[model samples]
Target: MLLPARTLRFCVATAAAAIAVTVGLTGCGSDDDSGSATGTTATASTTTAASATTGSGQAAGATPSVEELQTTLAILSDPAKTTQDKVAIVVDGEKRATNIESMTKALAGYGTLKFVVSDVKVTGDTATAQVVISSPNGDAPPMPLTWQQVGGKWKLSDASTCVLLGFAQAPCTP
Candidate 1:
């Protein structure tokens, strides 16, 4: 599961590899906001979704509804979504078109992943989502994902997206 040390930077090689494998291993799970899948429902409590406040240059957006985060995250983890579809969903995804394609290919046949959003916090326009990847296979420990408010919508952050791309051996730098 270990990749060459030189292949790692912001995402350690082993962790990156585990992510790719984790995506493939999960069955189906459901979050209160996201759609239903076949895996075990998360044990964590889902807070009531808050109305979103648009984030600007240095202002932080309010805690988004679980619906918003689930909606955006569903697209990010769905391998079947097109590159263009993904491009529009991630922060700075416009420029990471090629990198996105690489990840899509790497994750192809893994099917859609399910998740539970355990927590969310926004600092300025950037935010972090604590989530657990779920599947019929099992549930991963909670992991933090980055996000950003672009224009007015929440998009997965470029750094996190690139880490995903890295698992596919795509040459991307966050």
Candidate 2:
């Protein structure tokens, strides 16, 4: 299976709502005699942002600082936000909001989430950066991320949306 059922159950709590980087799994291959899933891939029908005004849609009004983006993500990643507020800091947040419940669950077992960003670059309404997500459990490998200036704030680029949502890697290309 591409994504284990247990992993999906754990991370799909808020889906893209939190932009937590939990890749979606479209299907899980049946287990062989040994009893193990086969592969993981994520696909979703809801692609476009519903209105683009979800918490993720709000713009920064200026070029976003790496620290600012990290702080916002930390707040959005909080599992408590599910009941307190549904302000998801992600790209096309309205579309991602559809899976808020799953995203929330993904954060339940994690410790405090931390992000380190470098090589901030901005050009017009687009930007790119090196990012790493870390926690007590483990640290995600650093990767380059593309961001878009939406409604004056920096949001994950569509390419990022494609990757996070379990779509093609080529979609990440400019």
Candidate 3:
């Protein structure tokens, strides 16, 4: 239940794509549910840009700021954390709490999920980052992942989570 039914070819979705439309979900390559971003645009105030820095004293394209690294750490947290807390670090978290839980458990035995973030772009509340993810299984190719600012805090976008869940070939369709 780590990845969605689609080979995780579904794994490399862009948050830019999710921000531009309503994302849809499906079963992970197995039982855990994750999804894809498709269809129309959203109604929220939207802004898109590739920034060199988020102005928090950290350059977006250079060394990842403390905030950015923190986000990456949240994604790789100990599996013992509550699903609610885990979900809190990702966009649309409440809706995908179950899938998050399933994926968390599935990877618990594998050890931590590791990542490196670079080439980051910040647009208003949404940011796109080039990321290389590694799990106990191995390292996945470098990819673009979207991040969102919700309630004044940054969280991994749902679309990005969908792709990440595939880190170990687990089915995460939502």
Candidate 4:
């Protein structure tokens, strides 16, 4: 039996959204050699400071408004925006490497993904947001994310337990 077009679209959108969340949470690694290079402490410190300051600056530039972040989340959550043509810019501009592949897999019936933002904290131009994501069968634990404001916009910066889950090996940088 053929499902309604709307139903098919809903399934696709839900799958895509799930992939975006998973990839956004666990992708990318900084190329800095601080951990391996001896006597690179100074460089590591500088890098950390720079990243922190950039986040702070971005959070500060928005007139203390959560509107931008909220709007971004809303747009991303929309099913209609799941198309590659529509989401390519967001994925590429944000440097979300894992999202595309994960999204494709999710669309192919891997599972469902859903999320909700519970809180947000902004200091200067940097902000941290807390979000919880759930899986399709409702068997997996909810993934918690710590999002950071960068370049005047919020992006997923860290996941508390992604490595443990084996979804990704590296943490997001920037």
Query: Model 4: per-residue lDDT, tens digit, 28-140?
Result: 43444344211100000001122233444442333323444434443433333444432332423334435433433333322233444444544454444434444333322
Per-model CA lDDT versus the true structure: 0.62, 0.47, 0.52, 0.37
- Candidates' TM-scores? 0.66, 0.52, 0.58, 0.38
lDDT of model 1 at residue 2? 26
lDDT of 1 by residue, 39-107 (tens): 222333344334443344333455555567776767765676788888898887888998878766655
Please, what are the lDDT tens digits per residue for candidate 2 over residues 51-165? 2233665543335677655544455456656523433455666555544445455544344556676666655566666666554434455555567776566666655444443
Candidate 3 residue lDDT tens string, 76-107? 34466678777778787777776777766655
Estimate the lDDT of model 3. Answer: 0.52
Superior candidate under TM-score, 2 versus 3: 3
RMSD of 3: 12.8
Per lDDT, what order, best first? 1, 3, 2, 4
Task: Mark the regions of model 2 whose C-alpha exceeds 4 Å error after superposition.
Answer: 1-62, 83-88, 161-174
Q: TM-score-based ranking, best first?
A: 1, 3, 2, 4
Residue 12 deviation, candidate 2, in Å? Answer: 19
| Model 4, residue pairs in steric clash | 55-126, 56-125, 56-126, 57-125, 58-125, 59-124, 59-125, 59-126, 60-124, 60-125
Candidate 3 residues lying further than 4 Å off, grouped into runs, are 1-73, 168-174
In angstroms, how far off is 70's CA in candidate 4?
6.8
On lDDT, the candidate that comes out on top is 1
